[model samples]
Target: MNVLVTGATGTVGAHVVDGLRYAPDAAVTAASRDPVTARERLDCATVGFDFTDPTTYRDAFAEIDALLLVRPPALSRVRRDIIPALSAAVGAGVEFVVFLSVIGADRNPLVPHARIESWIADSGLETTFLRASFFMQNLSTTHREEIRDGRLAVPAGDGKTSFVDARDVADVAVRALREGITGAYDLTGPDALSYAEVCAVLSATLEREVEYTDPSLPRFLVSRYRLEGDLAKAGVMAAIYTTARLGLAARVTDDVRSLLGRPPTDFRAFVRDNRTVWT
Candidate 1:
């Protein structure tokens, strides 16, 4: 089966590539905006693809059978980018889609994942929604600087989130693509923990004290904007944290075990395995 994996450079997508490496059925194509650089980095067949650009879809989806769609967090305009890409995929005769959506995306309209998930369902193509929880890799990427400084800043209020590892998400994606499973699967870690609890785990795992900074939205937005120089993106990010702060993203699910036939990786195990990144 020909599979096009979007966001090829990302944590989840990279692992998807790794999982499919041994899958005899999947001829995986890693799709990124810069196919030349992607080829060098991913060491796989690469194609130039962008959700925002309709023209890139034609060649990228050429003879493609299934899609592993990962919306880069920067792209927020679902109506403009996502729907058009799905339309293009349909036109390209792409039959199956395994979309990586966020946990509670169906109910939470604050983010673009919900809208994108809706569009995939309404597209009449066979679809499988991988409703993933907060990624455990956030410690190494988004919150790395904060974690390095001994504090993880966010506006999670009193909420708890099940932080699933990207590897598990990718493994599930590989299976769903190969088996062509339809409907939705909520991928989450075994335990649901608040930010404070997460920090405790980090402290224990890293053997150093880590604190949780529950900053206000405005402060987070301004700080992130100053750091990233993108107000719109920062605001969108703030809204995502705000939604989690409202206790909307705290649910834990057994879909990972059900999909993989084994228990998903837990927080302490993730931190222990990735300890070098923090140090």
Candidate 2:
């Protein structure tokens, strides 16, 4: 089966490539806008495919059997960038698609994932929707500096989240692509933890007294995210915090362990394995 994985250089997509490369029956193609640069970055075969460009969609989808579809966070124009590409791929007879959706997307109409999901259902293309939870990687990337400084600052209001590992999501995605599983599945870590609990875990792992601070909007926007005076970006950040605060992301599911037949990597292991990043 020829599998085309979009967003191939991203954290989850790259792991999908890594997992599928070992599948004897699956031929993996990493999709990117620039094949030359993509080829240099990815170990697998590369094709120049951009979500914003319909012209690039056909050639990349041609003769492709399966696809791991993910809407890049920055691409909010779902009807424009996503649907057209999906329509082209389906028209080209691509058999199945494994869509990387998010937790509570079905209920949250403001986000693009739900709209994309609705479009896919209406498209009648065989599909599997992986509604993955908050990524544990947020610590290592988006919220790392605070951890290093022994403080966890956010306006999440003590709501909990079941953060899944991106690698685990990728593993499930590869299985869906290869096995041709079609349905909506929730992939999450074993535990749902509040930011304070999260700090406790990190403190235990790092042997430091990390504290949690529910910072005000100005402090978080200007100091934490460093997007001062950028209302658009700040608004997006606020929406994300609202999602967490409303407890929309706190559900823990065994989908990863059920699919992989192995336990999902917990937050402690994640913090331990990526210890150097915090220090």
Candidate 3:
């Protein structure tokens, strides 16, 4: 099977690329905005792909059997940018699609994932939706600086989040691509943990005290705005945390284990493996 993985260098996409390397029957191509850099980094077949650029779609989807659709976080306008790309993929004769969506996206029409899911269903292509929970890697990538400084600041209140490792999510995506699995699966870690509990895990693993500030929504918005300097991006992040605060992100499931034939990686194991980032 030939597969194209969008956002190839991103959190979960990068891991997808790595996992596909071992799949003997699957030929994987990494899609990036910069194919030259992606080729150099991933050392695999790379294609230049941009969601807003229709011209790149044909070449990116050419001769592809399945697609791993991942939305770049920067692009928010789904109607203008994403829908066209999905349409192009269909036109190009792509057979199956595995969309990396978020948990609670089906019920929450406010998030872009919901609209994308709806469009894919109507597009008549075979597809699977991996509605993943909050990623544990968020601490290592998005909030790395805060963790380095020994503070975990977010607007998630005291709500627990079922955090899945990106590697686990990627493993499932690879399986879906190779086996032609179709349906919606809610992928999550073994436990739901609040930021306070997360901090404790970090402290024990890293041998340093990590504190959860439990900042309010307004404060988080201002802080994110200052950090990213983009109000729209900040607003999107605030909404995710708000979902957690409302106790909507804590649902755990056996989907990961069922699909992978193994228990999902726990938060403490993730911290132990990636402890260097915080140090």
Candidate 4:
């Protein structure tokens, strides 16, 4: 299998690239804007790919059998940026596509992932959609500084979220790429946890008191904007947390265990494994 992984250097995508290395039958290529850096970091075959640049598409998709398609967070205009690239992939004879999508994207047409999923399905190409839940890495990466400072603040209210590990999501994605699995799978962890419960786990792992400041929507928007210095990005994040606040992100599923043949990693296990980030 000749697999090309887009967003190959990102959170889940990086792990996907790493997992594909051990798949004997798969020839993995990490697609990046900078092929040189990607080659050095991932130590794999790479092709320079920019979604906005049509010229880069030909070589990126050339002779590729399967594509691990991941939408870069910065690119929200799917029709303008993603659809063209996917069209190019089809033209280049790419047979299978494993799209990394978000949970509830199928029902929510407002999100860009839904549009991409629709386009891929309409393209008549064999595809698998891995609709993953909230990533546990968010705490370690996006909210690391806050957690390290002993406070975790978001507008998630008392609603619980089923956070899945990026490593597990990557494993399932690799399996889909290699085996050509068809159908949508909702990948989530074993339990749904509220922010307070999540903080408790963090406290246990780091041996320090971790607090969850359940800020109001307006307060969250202001704080996030102040932290990120981008109101647009902050607004997007607020919307995501709003969904969590509404209890829309708490669904747990057996797809992870069914796909990986093992139980999904729990929040406590994830925090324990990555405790150094908080420390």
Candidate models: Cα lDDT each: 0.87, 0.86, 0.91, 0.90
lDDT of 1 by residue, 1-279 (tens): 999999988999988887786689899999999999988887889999988888898999999999999998778887876788889889999999999988888888887888888788888989999998889997788888879889988888878888899899998999999998888988999988899999998899888999998988889988998888987688777776776788877888889998899999989888888888888
Give candidate 3's error at residue 168 in angstroms: 0.3
Give each model's clash number.
Answer: 0, 0, 0, 0
Which regions of candidate 4 are displaced past 4 Å?
none
Candidate structures ordered by lDDT, highest first: 3, 4, 1, 2
* TM-score per model over all chains: 0.96, 0.91, 0.96, 0.95
Candidate 2 lDDT, 202-275, residue by residue in tens: 89989988998887766677764453445545555555666778899898888899999999999888998999
Error at 211, model 4, angstroms? 1.7
The C-alpha stretches of model 2 lying farther than 4 A from their native spots are: 216-237
The model with the greater TM-score, 2 or 3, is: 3
Better of 1 and 2 by TM-score: 1
* Residue-wise C-alpha lDDT for candidate 3, range 1-279, written one tens digit per residue: 889999899988988999897789899999999999999999899999999999899899999989999998877779998999999999999989999999988877767888899999998999999999999999899999989999989999998999999889999998998899999999999999998999999999989899999788899999988988987778777778887888889999999999999999999999999999989
Question: What is the C-alpha local distance difference test score of candidate 2?
Answer: 0.86
**Which 10 successive residues of model 3 have the least lDDT summed?**
231-240
Give lDDT for model 1: 0.87
| C-alpha lDDT of residue 42 in model 4 | 96
